[model samples]
Target: MINATILSMFSLSGLNDMTTKHRVTLFSFTLLCYCVILLVNSALIVTITLEEKLHEPMYIFLCNLCINSLYGTAAFYPKFLSDLLSNSHVISYTGCLLQVFVIYSYAATDFSILALMAYDRYVAICRPLEYHSVMTKHRVIWLVCFSRLVSLLCQAIVMIMTSKLELCGSHIEKLYCENWSILKLSCSSITINNIVGFIVIFFYFGHDLFIVCSYVQLVKSALKSREGRKKFTQTCLPHLLCLLNVTTALLFDLMYTRYGSASVPQSVKNFMAIQFLILPPLLNPIIYGLKLTQVRNSVLRLCRCRKQVKGLG
Candidate 1:
């Protein structure tokens, strides 16, 4: 077995082509984007928590969604900003594995949460009278916990499998550490890793299929009544849009990871690498904030209260 201690750090070669000027510009934009994500997501979470009227199953799930966005972004931005300012773009082996766990778990949790949201909509729209009984407070908490826990378990297994591999290289061509990138460095047969990875992907693919099926039934039932149609447009539309946004962002990253050509511009490749990390966190809250009437009103009310407090001061 190759000694794991030999590969202490992995050089991130993706940033090598950037000049000092470009790095500073990229840093400024990234910082601004990260701040916006934090502000919007935190605002939504706080709004949902404080407003007793908004403490229903739908809003609670929305709160968890925002929290997941924040969790995912925290894994990327701090280290990314530090790297942009540093001379060497390298991450320690342990740190790389940790990043893989956090980032992938965040993504998996997102899918889990979205799937739950789809079910919530299904019950709320398809069985309005039974919705309260079906989505009770205890059940909501259990569902939320299940979403987070399953993701953590899956990603932890991936991380464990990756850590056991003896790496032969210390260079990662991407901007961030991912399981596949680390797997590429393995000196031994990665058949087991590949199998486990495929299993995880297929499991989450099942989540996507579930969401799609849920929506299919929802749309069919919703079209029968004007009231149902309005409810679907008011609430389900935002969820659908957010789902599309994240799905598209992830597709870009996956395509680039699998089929990216060296002949492609480094800037384009870098954008693809970070698109999922950027667009979903930034867009989810915005889509929900503008689309969900309850959330929109709560946010406005909170803002107005803040302004009144400042005036009183």
Candidate 2:
């Protein structure tokens, strides 16, 4: 009875007034931003991978982050683009299921990468003497693989558990497929799915936030030594800003959805949507590159080299 009531309340609360023009405009802009983010992140990843100078643990984590961002974009943007291009925003049952899985998978992967990056920074700053042995290339590879595996397994379990519930309708009112949106579609009770989704969110977002904060604090404390202070601040500031932006965006999203008035203005939702979707990925590379002189120079040199190569080849 409690579960049924919750589902009823959720169904009643979900917005169903998405207009074609609004969706087309919003999705077009999202796609454009997505394209730019993809290009920039991919360029960074490629430059890092190709340039022998960037083979350190930090750049390796960045390359993994780039891949995770692409994974996330792949999971959602195709459907978003299709929804805009076609008048029908209806995704087939299979497609929706796939979207849910991949979206969560990439989300989990991203959290793990960020956490690992925090740890990488902690080691690089806090234990410079031990950094080389602690963060070997082999260890980094294994860590990434382990992170991917954990994320994939978690997403798989969540997807499988949620798949047991039957979707009764085709009206998903949100911009894209989300776990809650699918749950709202279920004719049956969704308590289990909601609980599982909460758990997943807690671990992915909540725990990651905890770990990043703790690691960053450790990095800051360890930077008091004269030798490590400058390098530590130089590296930590950009990541700290990135984390702050991401955390703020995520926290606002949660609060708005959970506690904000039911009749939140469409304008507010649109602002939140842009903040949540377009901003983090867009800013990540810029922040990361700007913080690191080496990365900044590398990007400039790579651009110049590319132009010259284009001119020659």
Candidate 2 matches the true fold with a TM-score of 0.86
Per-residue lDDT over 1-313 for candidate 2, one digit per residue giving the tens place of the 0 to 100 score: 3232222211111223557677678777878888898888888888887888998988888888777777777766676676566654565566767876886686577678778888888887777789999999799999999999998898888778766775566565555656666766677877887787778778878756666676767767665777677776687777777677666776676566545675877657646643645556678777888888878888889999989999998
TM-score of each: 0.97, 0.86
Candidate 1: tens digits of C-alpha lDDT, residues 1-313: 6644468889898888999999999999999999999999999999999999998998998899999999988989999999999999999989999998998898888888889999999999999999999999999999999999999999999899999988888889888898888888888889999899889978986888999999999999999999999999999999988888887887788767867898999888889888889998999999999998888999999999999999999
Residue 192 local lDDT, model 2? 80
**Could you tell me the lDDT of residue 302 within candidate 2?**
91
TM-score of 1: 0.97
